[model samples]
Target: MGGTDDNSNVRSVKMVFVTVGTTCFDALVEAVDTQEVKEELLKKGYTHLLIQMGRGSYFPKKSAGGSGCLAVNYFTFSSSIADNLKSASLVISHAGSGSIFETLRLGKPLIVVVNEDLMDNHQSELAEELAERKHLFCAYPQTLRSTIVIMNVDALLPYPPADAKPVAKLINRFLGFPDD
Candidate 1:
């Protein structure tokens, strides 16, 4: 299971943690600004705490928070989001296999941010699949502006499946190891 750290250096900002895999291609597409979402988040008094997946992406030096609106791109992960996922109060992330799985396992509320530029719209397909499973919130970039307003960060927690052993085995296989 994934874990979180309630205490972090990012406490000053309203933490909206994000993870987009290593390429940042998904990060670029998913990071598109829907002015409405930005405005709504600002109105709600939130400062965006972005944890981008790319180590090379451009991050702003300062942020405006809920006042003027600034996107502070914080840390990037070379491996998994398991560590940073704990620090987030809300997560806006790419709809990738690893990210979605970790989000569900962590029981954290997730906003399915799809990457349009990659894999023949596979991300959208995956988002739809996960949404069908009642795992988390899903929205297109266009709708994300409005959707963020109605999102209840607390309402997205998923109950772990009873048949968790198979899931655990699958994860072990994915991690390239035999189940213990």
Candidate 2:
């Protein structure tokens, strides 16, 4: 594990995981499914692209399991995406706090795509703040390609790990269970 490898068997797969959470973000799904995005990701040394499409009506038709150079796969939902996030070398996610912070806590490079069609769109504020701090890159569906082209994962600042104790205690009280 410590040695450098020039062989395929010794190399770990570099996967790029995309998630839209439980909301429908078809624009985002469509944006990354394009040939250009896939090629760009390959050029950036990523070996696979996995998308969690959420409840979006649009499903990616291009490359599923059998693709050239870059393998692309997508799904509507999953019981747990913690494993996916942990396995990913890079993450492209919706501007949802859960998705954003989860990836951030994993110390993975992240690109947050904002759903501008949403009514309030307060998620953009959070994305913008994180982007300002150099923790992640922010993009809209239209700018995803350009953002991908220019994104430098090495430049991102690592997000500090979050404390779950307070939240856990609050939930425990609400459920009438003693705090652990």
Candidate with maximal TM-score: 2
RMSD of each: 8.0, 5.8
Model 2, span 2-43: residue lDDT tens: 798667544358999999999999999999988888878887
**What's each prediction's TM-score?**
0.66, 0.82
lDDT of 1 at 64: 50
For model 2, the stretches where C-alpha displacement exceeds 4 angstroms are 1-11, 62-68, 162-180
Model 2 gets an lDDT of 0.86
**Taking the candidates one at a time, how many backbone clashes does each contain?**
1, 0
Report clash pairs, candidate 2. Answer: none
lDDT of 1 at 123: 60
> Which 10 residues in a row give candidate 2 its minimum summed lDDT?
163-172
